[model samples]
Target: MPTDIAFYTNPMSRGQIARWMLEEVGQPYDMTILDYDGTMKAADYLAINPMGKVPAIVHKGKVVTEAAAICAYLADAFPDAGLAPPVDQRADYYRWLFFAAGPVEAAVSNKSLGLTVPEGRERSMGYGSYDQTVTTLEKAVSGGQWICGDQFTAADVYVGSQVDWGLTFGTIDSRPAFEAYAARLRERPAYKRQKELDGALIAQMQKSS
Candidate 1:
């Protein structure tokens, strides 16, 4: 039997986020692993994602790109998975999801590259300042067991990835709240399964290289 979902990604990239989301959705998807310097930039994969990036998904013939978008898309596509909050009650869910994808992502990436906002230019940046963004993020996660409270929706998967990866890579501050939330996410079976699958793929790629 063929599945309608096709996942294009490299284990070493942010594709891990989508993989985790896929695992959480508990749906079968055929995955295509692309190499950064080669096939990813080739014309074939380019059609799926003009940017030639990993972590693009083709679901039922429609294309979805970007890790955060993919996470949210999967949640809605598979409502039975219960990964999204009720439609009318999704304010917080959408808030933190885009927050991580936008501000949090920008702040961390800029800091990693040693790029600062420069004096008086904080207002020019979407994240304002790295400190401000992380501080706000800390409060967001500290609000409840999940970003939207009690419900561990797709928001957790996206926001949690930012916190989890930030802690592991020293990209984001390891505040107590962040550490606690990440620890909880790590215990989820879906998170563990995603790590295991990606870990094995990473090892194989290393050995073959």
Candidate 2:
């Protein structure tokens, strides 16, 4: 398989999470920045990712989409990064990864869009309600330093992104556990690298536009 990886993203999007994962893996890769109105919706880009979304990666002649999936894939692909948990610890790793990607994402996003899951339908919806989602989520992750326990894994990339974004936008509650967790996430070398690089890219884009 070809080792070269191509990352498709815009500096201001969730692609930052995938960029952090790539940095943690410490591999050289190419990045393609797409503007919302320009190349993002073009036919060629759509062929690589039907959704035309930011944060997609092409490696080993395979395309990987979705932030959490990309994070987990890079972690396992580059085991030297030590970002993937051992088999025994994978339960929590996978649990929180999918939880953040699915329920947490839906709850937070829907809430942001001003859509409610409705009062009686909490039991029916996968995410329950926004309040219940964030509350239960805090217990599972915020209380602990990392989702899979002490050693941070790819799970942190996904979970931390949600937490950091939520706290920044005030979409989620500013609980003590959350503040402490976001603070720790911002301290990571890889995360900082992503912030610096993406920040500069965002600035450059803004100036050029």
Q: Who wins the TM-score comparison?
A: 1
Model 2: colliding residue pairs: none
Candidate 1: segments with Cα more than 4 A from true spot: none
In the range 145-208, model 1's lDDT, one tens digit per residue, is: 9998898999999999999999999999879999999999999999999999999999999999
Q: After superposition, how far is residue 207 of candidate 1 from its true place, in Å?
A: 1.0
Q: What is the lDDT of candidate 1?
A: 0.96
Per-residue C-alpha lDDT of model 2 across residues 63-172, encoded as one tens digit per residue: 99999999999998989889988988798899889999999999999999999876688888889999888998798775467887798899999999999999999999
- Give the number of colliding residue pairs in candidate 1: 0
Candidate 1 TM-score, C-alpha based: 0.99
Worst 10 residues of 1 by lDDT: 144-153
